[model samples]
Target: MVSELRIGILGAGGIAERAMVEPAHEVEGVRVVAIGARDPERARAFAERWDLPKHGDYETILSDPDIDLVYLALPPITHAEWGIRALEAGKHVLCEKPLSVNGTTASAIADAAAATGRRAFVGFHYRLHSFTRRLLDVIASGVLGDIERVDVDFSIPHFVVKPGNIRLDGDLGGGAVMDVGCYAVDLIRAAWGEPAVESATAVLSDDDPRIDLQTDAVLRLSSGAPVHVRGSFIGDDQGAMSLRIEGSEARLAATSVIVPQWGATLRVSAGDGLLLEEKAAEGDNSYARQLEHLVAVLADGSPSILDVRRGVGTMRVVDEIYRAAGLEPR
Candidate 1:
């Protein structure tokens, strides 16, 4: 059996409690060695529950000699600072999505990781799903002929209403575009192989002046294809999240694109009026699979799918979207 990777969690927030702490315990080649949080009581409680070593400050965990990896589940604004510190401390890091609040910070962390010779991975867990992998293959294979246009919708319910949640604040790197809209941008770039954003137009709501709670933009790609993206915090809980690509000879619609827990549905309509649909098998834990991939890559010294370079590009697009909307990135 492969040696279990020793992991230390930097934050015991909701994500750490629900996704990392629980599922990681179930993986064979993984072990939770330590946890750190701002609150001593809370961190200790989490460690007691998970049977791990707990610390009130992140540096305590970082200094531990037994930990092999560190997972940063902190706020987006703090991602770069903590990530850099962890890498300099000689710990491999798996940072949560968006990489950072903007492209500049993202690039800084990426450079730090490269300089340290330490493995760096992002928590773009959607890329780990088998269904999404197969969809990427189909798109790259050109089975549907030349691409024409792409329409994407990424939305979620109002899940966070608490005060100072960090997700709704603009200065702390919170917004509809920064949150749910990232998926739309990344998936489009992945399909197009490059983000040739010639121009963009966006509509913002007035309810939240601090952030773009509702944003819809039209982006032009290098291939001369027009892609429309709609991301919002005001959509219904039952709203759709998928990408529809119109090609020369066929059209591809990826149903259940955002929330793969509902299972993925792919539909292809050929020029001859024939249509085909298929559903992707579901897994209980995407987070587990993502960690598994990180461990495997670290073991073999292979590259990761969502490495720092890709994350920097995604953040750059996000910075552009914010600029087009007449809002300076926070």
Candidate 2:
């Protein structure tokens, strides 16, 4: 039985395009029925472009009876409010990563979803990727022995190149931490359970002190394994999208953990002898995998992978990192 899942998008943006609109077309039994943006004209344009059947404002999607799932592709600051609303409206929610600007709001959304008995998921698509599972499997197999420390980073030149991008705007829940760092934080939490933010510091943009141009944070898991997470928008190289795990027995390194649809490479070594090396075939979209999970969760009553509780936990680390860095949380 192919049970259909109807999706209503609350934001007409690039992420909605990449993570939902585009993937919705490829995945079976998933339909993006409606799309809404603050700008009605933009929503209409996006609807037409994506071949969505309907378009309107956020309220319209929430009010629709047939829209069983609401995908909140809005900014971090807006996630909690609308996520709760969609949950209350009898719609499950798939919010873009970060969940919210701070842990408090994320917790509120988690509570609302719990109260409503509705599923709410955060969009950390990479967590659903095979690269992540393989990395974890390698470590769990004891090939890496006891984890000593982990290093994960995702950086780009968006700060220098993409002028006026929403991610660079502080008031709109913009910052390197809120934008890209959440993925790093989530990956760390996924690899090593919840962590305590030991210390954090960031290079704030001279123009916008509220926005971190580059963030370097250190966290300690309960197992005493240390994690170094670096997220940046201003960078010299193409990007540093990789993870390194140092253990008592060996070292595991992975590249392109973020979007393996682009490319994925892995290397395991110890004392200069490469134990293993491999590359994943390109073209598997993590977003499509995520959509399939969401659909299965709804249809078969399956457990969610990135549920609200995990989202709130990730945001707690993010907020703690902000406090440790001497900046306000979002």
TM-score of each: 0.92, 0.96
TM-score of 2: 0.96
TM-score of 1: 0.92
CA shift at 131, candidate 2, in angstroms? 1.9
Task: Give lDDT tens digits, candidate 2, residues 1-330.
Answer: 227999999999888998998888889989999999999999999999988889999999999998999999998889988999999999999999888999999999999989998889999887777776776677678888898998988888653537587887888889888888899888877766888999999998877789898999999988988899998998765787889999899999998888876778889999979998877666678899899888888887777768989899989889999999999998
Once fitted onto the true fold, the runs of candidate 1 whose alpha carbons sit more than 4 angstroms away are 158-164, 198-208, 271-275
- Model 1 per-residue lDDT tens digits across residues 106-126: 999999999998877778787
lDDT of each: 0.79, 0.87
RMSD of each: 2.3, 1.6
Where is model 2 more than 4 Å wrong at Cα?
A: 158-161
